[model samples]
Target: MSIFNLIVALGAVTHKDSDHERVLIKRIKAGDNKALEELYELYKSLLFGMIISIVKKREEAEDVLQEVFMRIWEKAHTFDENRGNVYSWIVTLTRNKAIDRIRSKGYKTQEKASTSVDEPEFSLEGDKFDPLETTIFSDRAELVKKALEEIPEKQREVIKVAYFGGMTQSEISEHLDIPLGTVKTRTRQGLIKLKNILEDHISRNG
Candidate 1:
């Protein structure tokens, strides 16, 4: 086909993607075998791009891509749109699975790691979060920093001296030429205020 005809054909398929994806997801959730074909058609390129980007070897990428789609097929029921958009979920899963594979096998041949069990790092994922879960961590960190900035200059300085500078309240009092009791009170209040602001911010977000 000519370039124009190819573009027209792609446009037609592009327009159908949203509906196609929704249907595929529903069918996959319902345990339809053919839905796997839809998934391959939908995300093979994206998963391959992610695998190639990370593994950086054609054969390795292909191997990782297979693992990724297999997990996607098995975990179709875990695809929650409320957590994130479809693209983000797939990309996160693909990238993470590839990285986990590489780290396990030292990025050697594709056969070195074949879905092992009992990883120490797996349990650490309780506090561990991906960029896919929520951008809230970084956003709240910035906001807390800015909110700390909103506090009185002296309070901010004292809190920084105590928290970031690893100084005790008495040390802050000596350094800032303030009474020890005053330093302690300021430190306590600064923490309380920051905690309140953080809680309020989290509530607003959720």
Candidate 2:
């Protein structure tokens, strides 16, 4: 083939690729898996590169890359045509998800490392469980911790005295030197707040 003809053929190939990609995006948004596969072929390497940059491990980045695509596929109808093109959108999602996974896992690791090795020095249930039970209990414990953290400090202290220490409200008032009405109000509000937090947790977990 003549060099000039070869150059023209290459340009035609490039234009065909770009045109096919545009059609693939439109069809993928319409829930066509074939089009999604074409879109995946066009953009997978780009997506993987962005993920690997953030997550820094080939396996983890690859897993996150798949997650990003699954989200895109599941949510394609939600994508707005006015919001730039599909390639750019997929790249952004891939980077964001990979970074989020990396940060989340890193934070958990750091928290476990920083926590004391000692036990709580008291028996709630001895902290032993099968894997499934431990997962459920851990989730509940986290929810409880988050709920307690939302309470105002003084009310939380008052609650600790009444519940954990087995003191009556009147005893709590006497011990804390607060008015009985104030103690009761704090307890009431604290429990209401705790209930709200627990309801939110159930909704999320369920």
Candidate lDDT values, in order:
0.58, 0.58
Model 1 stretches astray by more than 4 angstroms: 1-17, 106-206
Per-residue C-alpha lDDT of model 2 across residues 1-206, encoded as one tens digit per residue:
22112222322322333567667667878889888777777666545544554444556657887888788788787777565555445645664676477558673485467644322122224543221121112445445556767989987777655532335678878989999999988888877776676667667766
Score candidate 2 by TM-score against the native: 0.42
Global Cα RMSD, each model? 17.3, 22.5
Question: How many steric clashes between backbone atoms does each model show?
Answer: 0, 0
lDDT of 2 at 104: 85
- Clashing pairs in model 2? none
Please, what are the lDDT tens digits per residue for candidate 1 over residues 1-206?
Answer: 22112222322322333667767877888888798787887677545644554444567667887888788778889988665445555656776776666556466444455554222221112644222112112344346566677677877778755432335567778889999998877766766776566557657775
